[model samples]
Target: MIRTTATLLLLALPLAFTRPAAAQETPIAYTVAFPNAVHHEARIQVTFAQLPAGPLQVRMSRSSPGRYALHEFAKNVYDVQATDSKGNALSVNKPDPYGWDVTGHDGTVVFTYTLFGDRTDGTYAGIDKRHAHLNMPATLAFARGLEQRPAEVKFELPAGWQVASQLRPDATKGTWYAPNMQYLMDSPTSLGPQQTRSWQEQDRTIEMQVLHDGTEAELDSYVGLTKKVVKEAAAVFGELPEYDFGRYTFIANYLPQTSGDGMEHRNSTSLTSSRPLRGPAALDNLGTVSHEFFHSWNVERIRPQDLEPFDFERANMSSNLWFAEGFTQYYGELLLRRAGVYTDAEYCTEALSGIVDAMLTMPGPKRYSPVYMSQQAPFVDAAAAIDPNNRSNTYLSYYYIGAGNALALDLQLRQNYKTDLDTYMRAVWQQHGKTQRNYAPAQPYTLRDLQRVLGEVAKDTAFAGQFFRQHIMGHELHKYDALLAPAGLLVRPARPGQSTLAARLQYNPDSTATLGTTLLGSPLYVAGLDREDVLLKVEGQKPISAKEMQKRLAAHKPGDVVPIEYRTRNGVRTAQVTLQQDNTLEVVPMPNATRKQLAFRKAWLAGKAK
Candidate 1:
């Protein structure tokens, strides 16, 4: 019973090849196929040359690398089988939801399975007639104890499909080599016709492979702007990381067929969007690209201790998401601006949007600390299900709070010490993220580590400790107005005496307005209007729509009384609510700021250009 490898190689089909025979060789290799693209299925055969004495524990990832929540990837896998070198069947047992335990096999075993992928995002796999986007954790299965062993993966593309991934090529065509399961799982593959471009910056190479339904000229222009982003981001670290793969690939899909996401890895990022890269929607895609590119330095390597050696069987929680994800977000916009992708007005507008979301729009920060939100990421990141809890009233996304923290820190450092958050981040990169470290689960830095670094940078241990306690661990927000003073920026609320409902409203197709979340102590909250309450009438009259209610309320004075009728799960109710003056905050340029303040603001916005 000869194996299928010999026949496949003769046919020029993609084949997985192990290394030259040696002691302690790699335990596993896989060859993948796309036989039924219309059904969105991927067939994979994993051959294990060296198995443990007992049963081999092979499992699908419950959580992916760089993602915090439990995805339960095994739910998408089916048709599992195990065989020996001679193609004879072996005993396979389902021990748990994640894995199959194979026994009654010699030292060598061959496993085959089929995976169904309908979604194409950063975290999930997508297979179709045009292309196959493989998120490894969502498609591949790995043995428990073979994580340290090197692995080889080969793809049998459909017809004229070509492959683009960060995984380096081996001696064979269409095959790639990974140092270990960790690196292999972190690498996502995009196979189809692609618009590929390459460039060099310092000692590293940058590659962009896009499968977009756009012109080659548009792709080139996007790549040109992306190169500028890369240059500006490197300046923050003072240098580029010695990328292990010798290059970084931006695996992007901009067809109208895919859902949108931008996930970061050590050597590449998975960027998917339904939005095309030609019109007004193109600018929004740039933000995702820049944000994920920044992660190549931040979360991908600078290392969060809790997320190190990411677990596949359970949720991997990290409290540094505020810094890992939030700081990346802060730089995403700032670097785009620094790269000349944004005007000064655009940068301020975006920055101010974040500040307002954290300070007033989102009620999460007023009640909970940023650290608490980071800790709750396991339940909230891409979390989708039926929920009864009011997230707006109780939860603010860490990304919002963290970016706000970055803004405050940047301004405070600039005003007080003549340094900025970029300098502090560079120091962190130097200490933990340098390429030589090869950090894993036990090697990540913690909140304490951040404090230590801040203290060293600030030359004030007490100040660093207090900053963390008050701003991060504690719920107190930074003094944004005071911090922004030297930068010629001021936080101001909208004009007073114009009334507002002070609640977020979701308009349903049935012409009902449901309250989503309201600011604490605002007119909505003061009137006891709760989340999920359907608005029925305003001022004793049934409103045609939520917009009409808002327009009517905005016409009244702050002290006017408005009758509100709403329905909750319990019953219908009516109440007389005193409207509050519109107080939404805005970030504005200080008209009376001194020359020094203007200079600092320009320097902060444009970096070297200023």
Candidate 2:
């Protein structure tokens, strides 16, 4: 998945099943109907045939691929019933919150349930009069001990609705096929009145299927931009992955009812957004398209060993998301720049600046390594909770940390090794990603394998080992200013002389201000101020608004001490805090760039497509 959450776009081609069903086993069959779609409900049934046991265990998925969190998909299921092959009522037992155990099945059990979903994003299902957006794990129930069996699904669609999915199309109309449970769960489906465009790339079909409220002209313009993005993304890898079925699809929903998300699958991506593709937002939406398409190589194939064989029963965690997700983050924007969707200045100020600033200013990266940050995804990647967490102070997203690392590494490789990130990516691709085994990578990489590959790419094992030890496994950052100098870019403070308390203040109508999460080393934290503390005065003057607070702080310089009064849970108190300079940074072009610098920058940013 490209975002924290998690598409079905498909192109049909002549291809053999990646995993063929055994002679003795029967395919698990599923039927889905949106009879109550107007009420956001789906009727789903699964038939497990040739069951050998006295009891059959059936369950909903607790986790999704690409998303590291547990989503508890079973909560949306209701009115579950079971029956034997002869249509007799079977005994259904509730063994746990996630599934049911059925007895008296007579070697076959047909399980039925009602699923209600309103959200239209990667992790959940959405059904309406307009369409049915299905993320399989959130829509289907699977039987245990039958995971290796082939799976077939048929959707009973409303009039004029077409199916868009990566799942293999069966000979029967509205039916799709998956060789096994893993592939079935990874495939998302969108059934609606959709507009589709197809093109050939490397003799493989590339498709774009859109469910939108926009005009045909708007869709046409978006497809043009998508073509540029797809071409540039393939340039980074030198070639696209050998997509299963010899095709890849981009399934997008650009409707007001859709939520903003992008999820990558083996051969397709699910893109949902409320933003219309007719204005600047169209380009913004393309950023996600760029990100997810890059994942076809980086994540779907060059996978983390920890995430291979994704567990649908619980949270899936990985220590290499920084590289898996973050490097893709770096390239996502970079590809846009390469495709001319964004100019040099736009890339630097809009994309690079944020990445560099976040790594430098955020306390999380200073306190924890990229590996540690990646491990926190299960808690932060759309995982819901009631209690408050100090993630603002202690946790930085692996996405940002990894992009920062990728930026530094890319520059380091260019400067020190006479190679660049694109070269390194190709190396990783050749070693771990190029070969596919059924639905997964033939050689899923480990942390050590990544380090070894870096060493090989750089042609210096010592430097690679040192680089990993410092920036990846250890909490250390590269000198950005020096590294970016060769390309005529400068990393400098956004506000050079401004003094700040470094705490977000939410001003209340009652003439007081409440603090957001204070940074670990900020002035507020040093003065023992934390989240939910109400500020009454700064330097003995009551600041009524954020502007007033800033006006008061502008009177002082960095290192100046000021008295503040605030109300904590214990009561009101006063403390003296020493202010610090605003450390927010930005990357900008040098004023007098040399010819060599210009050449280097152009070579790095220009499109690599042939």
Candidate 3:
């Protein structure tokens, strides 16, 4: 049965009852309680074994692991009070935006603060009567220089509520242990009544803990689908990552009250969405499961130097997130298709339209390369508030470009070298990720490291160097038409001779409209039409909608001049634009393919060397 919020809360036991600490290990202990979930507030108590010699500074993270943005988590904390082991009050000062400095604390220091969490996603914490979704970095505070210190966390849950996390269980009930602060902050905990399913994958355990409005039967089916994905994904790398804790957990909250997010960690992933476990929502959210699970190898342990020992004081920027996140995006879809969750037609449609078509048609890559997009992640990756920029015209998600590169590289290897991307990725895993090596910031894989691995896989350094130069370091997009020809696939225009408006259209019911991207080199660009230009009219009549504007433009052939009116900072204006044919592409199978084409296609899809 799906447990209701009131039922979950009724399960909570009183705070007067305390659990015993781990045997002789008095690690930094944290107690979290949700007394009034309706207020979206949580009471957190932190106890340290001893105080530092000087002023003790405790801080909330500015950035969390696996995220690139600076969240400034301290903003949500209130009613903070610090005291000694005797409960004597201590003086606390807010010296900075991210931390508090406590002084005059003898021997032991215990602090309590109320944290507000209204959003339920991978990056932030959220607590209500129904459940508590904890992203440790956002909900817990760590001492300034004791990141290596062991810690224990205990939840004062509503009666009958259970907990799901990646952290190992301690001796006490409702308590977990982390070897150090890094692990503590990296471990996210989900609390509530949940339907759980578990299976053993060889030596490692795979578990799913789900809290949703859906039924247990739905959750059971989803778990079965998840097992398929895990198997297929493991086949790509030829092995599973060393699950650090000997278990990998998928902690998901699909309640209507939760916000949507998917985040990866060393041994687990947190997936929260408003979507359910059945129907189309299942497919929609499973991609996140596949993607984050793949990350157990890619970013979690394979590691990026800049992101290592993740910075909590500021944004964690990395130029390799293009490869880190983007390649995973490619595998997310591919693995799903391989697992039979997606049919061939479904796979082809999404790849051609969503990833390929979007990347090829967007003007952002024409201006900025994939590496630049990866660098821009600090501002773009989930950094959505207070943004006023016209990013549509200037930025393409790194995931799109990265996935496109993966496609191009995969095809090129198959065509020229009788190899594929799987071989290259596996080689990387064996060398960098397999050793369970904790990468140092100074030792992260550079572009050269990637090129070297590709060269090794293809046995052709020249091709690897050139591919990296053109697609990774430079902005040259692949011509997929040539890349897919050998695999019995053809790229063609979705609509023949259809004229493009060039500028992306956002229209209101009142006929007011705004432009999103006036793509460069298109008719709109040649005609001086730009982003943020409010569409006042077209040929003296206000555009009723995007379809109306498209219909009007479709009436003319290429080279036909049309009058366009728009508003900008300079006020009303008019321009004569020459209509151009839309170049949006789609991939279609060659019904009558030659034997060689079919052979190449089979080898590519089978992930086998030619």
Off by over 4 Å in 2: 1-24, 171-173
Residue ranges of candidate 1 with Cα displaced over 4 Å: 1-23, 171-173, 438-443, 494-496, 507-511, 517-519, 591-593
Model 2: colliding residue pairs: 7-269, 7-270
* Candidate 1 local lDDT, 79-119, one digit each (tens): 99999888999999998999999998888889999999989
Pairs in steric clash, model 3: 11-158, 11-159, 11-160, 12-158, 12-159
Against the reference, the lDDT scores of all candidates come to 0.78, 0.87, 0.79
Error of 2 at 110 (Å): 0.8
User: What is the alpha-carbon lDDT of model 1 when measured against the actual structure?
Assistant: 0.78
Model 3 poorest ten-residue lDDT run = 1-10
Ranking according to TM-score, highest score first:
2, 1, 3
**Model 3 spans with C-alpha error above 4 angstroms:** 1-25, 171-173, 385-387, 437-444, 606-610
Task: Judging by lDDT, tell me the better candidate of 2 and 3.
Answer: 2
Q: Which predicted model would earn the best lDDT?
A: 2
